[model samples]
Target: MWDRLATDGLAILVIMCLIELIVPSRAKGPVMWGFNLVFSLMLFASTLYYAHFGSVPTYTALRELHQVPQIKGSVESLIEPEYFLFFIDLLVLAILWGVTLSKPKSMRLGRRPVWKIGVAAAGVVSLILSGWYIHNGGKIENEIVQAENLGFLDYQVAAVLKENRQNDEITDGNLGKTKSEVKKLQATFAYKDASSGKGNLQYFGAAKGKNLIIIQMEAFQNFPLHLSLNGQELTPVLNKLAAEGLYFPNFYQQIGQGNTSDAEFMSNTSIYPTGTIAMSTGYGDRELPSLPRLLEKYNYESSTFHVNDVSFWDRSKMYPALNFTHYYDKPSYTNDHFNAFGASDEELYRVGVEKLSELHKQNKPFYAQFVTASSHAPFNVPKDRQRITLPDSLQGTELGDYLTAINYTDYAIGTLVERLKQNGMWDDTALVAYGDHFGILPKLASEEFISSELGIKYNDQVSRYNIPLLIHIPGQSSGKVVERVGGQLDILPTVANIMGVSLAKEGFTAFGHDLLNVDHNIFGMRYYLPTGSFFNDDVLFVPGKGFDDGTAISLKTYEPVTDITKYRADYDYILKLMKLSDAYVKQLPKRGP
Candidate 1:
């Protein structure tokens, strides 16, 4: 019973409650203890159920809690039916206790009103519990099926610790020879694999190394370009760039590091963001085979530049880890100081133009990375920087603030392109720009507001994951839109493929395919598993696990899948991917400050 209490406090609550009724009704403090235990146990049980067998509501709640510093909304919208059911269960136990104590012989103070209260309480609890059971009968049954396979029920508190602390790795620090110890731990628990492709790894592919410039935009979504107030364009610069470059219509962002830095790391290195810490915060200064490092082998001078504090998210450490030879942070750009956030996007572009000119003087092939910062939380753009105007219908709020930042960034992109043309490198340089992930807009806003701005349903899985990817190679003329499902993880391998570099066989294997080529159809699992989210062309499946309360959403008709077992086989692959990412993340360097 003691062991049971440790493992499941809620189960013990039910037993304790029954025991209290055996005692006389006059036993005041003990009866109060039982009630307190029941309340505490119910809360604990809800948390345990979420930890072990959390369905959609639980998972969503967890994700929302970890949202970036500024976004605000209620987490109640994401809760599943299990939360209500748990309350009903506790209520029923409460009513049952009241009923027996209400007997006249058992309690001289017992009266008709006491009986009345018992009946009302029982009726309410019974109604709620029965309704929930009826509505989610299949889900509850499915959960019971999964529960049958339970082992020690050891809680995985690691995920919670990771979310809160953001820096505790499996190993104490750099594991050294104990790297093997970490590896053993991963193998013992079955960590996920991070790589996905089966082809030969490539390194420096540039026979004639042209300069490379990668722009990872923060919170840049496709919505503003699609927005039309009475058919007026909100984003002219974005529209211009779209026409000038190759836009990937189906490109997706597999969220990493919980924000822009994560997307930048995965896209730049093609490695899963797992283990001790996000590559940005943890591995930036460590040795890693990122775009800069890979390009360095081919005599390409590589540098990373960001329009924010170098210390923000620890990019100062990450840029060096990826082997960038030069790094320019906020202070690097003169006349560009505005917010503490970083240099404005326009100034970052201006500095890029200057740096490109300086690199031209050096007469060396170069790789430069720019991480934008202003479009991040707070979402405010400077008065001079704000280029796009919103109608009266869209003024005075965070959403409007976010829209202005995006427009300003788009304008900055246009200015940079023009700068490239002026420098005569427009024809030779390869330019790649993409959003790190979805913008953290408030979900509580009107659906029409989101749909109008983004050109798609804002809450849809596709909209959540889908962002823009643009690759412009002058004189390539092949501007056709590629509709294959791809992700931020595909960026490194795809760029390597374009540059003709071969990767090391053991060190780096890409989870993404080369989108420039038409051969591979690899798609990434979008969310966590055994019951998370999966993406394919024909359908979008979101299976709720630990219970039958799973959801499968279709992209085409916006249909939800009530019965998810039809795709049970897919869960195997999803779990495999999860293990791989976890394993490799554990393998990442856990260096000290």
Candidate 2:
């Protein structure tokens, strides 16, 4: 904390000196007090944000602040008693303020010409020191490390400067040229098998001409798939689905600031979230090349269902951007007393089945997406609504509540499956259900705490980011536990492969590869992890300022890898790939208003 003092301290000093030089002597106290309060509040928010998201809060984060009221339960859950210590200094300040108010007159620190000159010089000196601190840390692609090195206030400023620099790069990139460069670089990675000299024809046409149904489960994790709480299976329905489908146990979420919405964006578009902002909020105006758009050529009518308002997370714009033929939101579903755009996952699927069954009767193939919210943060489900019985250890605990919500979510999907079968749409449809992101935040349930409770070796980041990806193609009898390391970005290409849709033939530019065909794969992640952090077939590698001080842990074994020099090339490749992805998405043509 002391080492970080240079950045924040210098910044505060500059501000204090500036106020002294500019403000009236009588009003100085109130102004400084207000500044202090704002500073403290920002620090407090940053702390809680780090606790919840495991990333430093930047100015970009403020754009999502408007979303806080909608997720008030989640925000409240993130707060702790100890976090109020950030405002302890304010207690004394407030008391002093009251005493000063009660007094007959206020004392003034007389400011002469020499004193003003000294204050100005001090401000200039402190400003330079703050800039120096920012300069030292700004080059770091790792946000967490940069926050530690530059302190919180300076880090925000550094982020803006870095963002501008990256913007310049984005502005300079050409769409056609970038698409070519992406393909050229991707060929070097060789996603398809060299031995077969073909695309993943194994799964090609596997579910061709079938309707598509994708369930974007909320805050669900991979660990609960085959696990039991006491004697009860936590997610029996999902376990059954995993048994019947191809499940990617090594899959991780690639969501950014938009979280669930970002998962949808990546799954549909095969584009990076840019990590700095929510893709839906930022690029909802662009005409995205998506699964819905791709399937349209094959005569598949696309629709999406969410229990929340379409305006939430700007999904109203994103659905159009993705070129969905239809969408169902709040008014389309029955409200079950879920407030502030929250809904039971069961109701969400119930409506999805009802609407899609109509399309089934019409004999039209369709692509339908359902984004669930029942298991969102601070997972709450009435006891009557819960599916699995919890043990004494988990009962009433956040972990317990989370498990119950996940179980209910899985059960809801089971209803969707049964309804599809009853509606005669099951055998002709490709069913896919995957978690949008991990449910359990570390602050509520620490790795050690969860490991002890569940009797499993739970890694904080590795297991936390590990979301389940299951694809159930019609007529496939048994399940295959795919061992390939994949992210949410891989969903589109993988689904396309199963449905026999060739993105290359359509001239579509995709940053992600077909997980089924990739013998070797590497993908970058940011917003949650540091910018240059990537997961390869072997390990999850995270860089320090650059690749030299980076660390690696085996993806399979969850053990640290000491010698990471060999993985440096993979790190470099992923960095370039993500940058190109960011550039490509920015270059996309805007939709006609």
Candidate 3:
């Protein structure tokens, strides 16, 4: 809780400082100091409470802050001071400082209209922003409250601690401690890295000499598969490859830490997801045993390719932790420029091809991991492709732009496939492509776009988590569609299966199953924010935590199963997964049995 308050306070203070710089204020110092002192005191008090009483009261306070607004249909219902007051306090202090610093008697409202206008504009902006901050904080608090009622607070608290711990100084002891935690974290999952079992590269088929390529496509969604009057087929290349590849149609992703590198860590290392900031931001310095190191035992070269800022998510250190021999980020690419997210997909694919060809020429099989960035928010694609126009339904909205970006990325994939075929590298190489997670369609947009597109009310928990996964094995004409639901965690075992490696028996007992195997039964838990969904063979549970003490009823059946304890157990699993995910990414090895 202090971490949250501290982070928020730091951000607010930074913003206030920046504002002061832009509009020099002499009189505001006293008010700013007073405001800071008050906030500091409040923060200290809260920290004391958290340490003494535990997170229970803090959690309770948070829950109470989210209660349905007393006044119906009031935006005030959305405002929660506890959450947003930290920022408000900063803004208020800054304003008070500015006002106090100003020589009011000498100040002329008309004499210096420019400064007055600037100050007024800044004040308005601050007030609007403060309002929004409060609203979102309240809204999120409500969601947290609901989740807590359903027993997710423990996981939430665990997530808070795990995230904070990662930012601590990276010491050998810390790394060693991380290594110990990995065992408990991985225990929550079923399968172990096959390489962990025998310490023999041959058992995991790393000796088979098959090249591996894992691609994490940003903001890829399943809606594009449905051809509409205005919606262009977004992934023709992947759809075409689906005919020749082993397609896992029912695969899901258990995304953690809302960052691409974190997704890569989870997918590659079979770690669970964390509920906090991007794992890369927090765990970049920790040492851990990752897939790259495990595969290095078989003499395979490993590399990571991200056509974006190398420092965006602290990828500089993370790639090394994963034991990649090389990392090719924006600096390495001198071709086309990137827009909103980063480099154009065309450029990314072209650069990736050149890199792959170079590695192939060396006669050393390599793991070339490429992360796509074009399909991210703002949906900036090259202007050359025909712009995709959505129906009246999505026109002028972010969804329309998002789909257009998807189509652009699909074309880039097509180009990549053609290049591989032309170079004769298509036959022996393997292609694994999966979306990082669902695109961010704001609530209004989700209702207008996703709900309309699917012809189903998108209110339930399960609808948002659906994504696409495609695995293409060169020259292996599987042409098989497997409907068994799986997630990124299952990818390791599935790859091991294809590469002909055996997963550790005890490891498979936790979370992942071999995708190619029919007897495996697995469950998945997914979250986007406060709301979340859990899926198993039996049923897909959409749990609203705060409503009626958490488990309200099946949105589909309206049958009540409000067992707070059950919800708590599920949340504990989520918490466990979050820790495991980070520990794995930091390449910290679990204590072996």
- Tell me the tens digit of each residue's lDDT in model 2 across 1-593: 68788778888898899899889877988897999899889989988878777789899988777777778888888888988998898988989878766765434233567778888898999999898888887888888999889988888899899888878987887799999999899988756566867543668879999999999998989998899877888888888878998989999988888988999999999999988888888999999989998999999999999998888888988999999989999898888864356567778888899989998999999999999988887787876786777778877888888988888888888888899989999999999988899888887888888889998889888999999999999999899999898999899999999999988798988888888877878888986788899998889888888899999998777899999999888888888898899889988999998
> How well does model 3 score by local distance difference test?
0.57
Quantify all predictions' global Cα lDDT against the true fold.
0.58, 0.87, 0.57
Task: State the TM-score for model 1.
Answer: 0.66
lDDT of 1 by residue, 150-255 (tens): 1112122222333344234433344353334433433332122335454443223432367788889887775566465446566676565566666776777666
Q: Choose the strongest candidate by lDDT.
A: 2
TM-score, candidate 3, is: 0.65
Q: Tell me each candidate's TM-score.
A: 0.66, 0.96, 0.65
- Model 2 misplaced regions, further than 4 Å: 94-107, 338-341
Q: Give the candidate order by descending lDDT.
A: 2, 1, 3
Q: Which candidate achieves the best TM-score against the true structure?
A: 2
Off by over 4 Å in 1: 1-208, 230-232, 282-286, 335-340, 452-458, 504-507, 518-531, 546-549, 561-566, 588-593
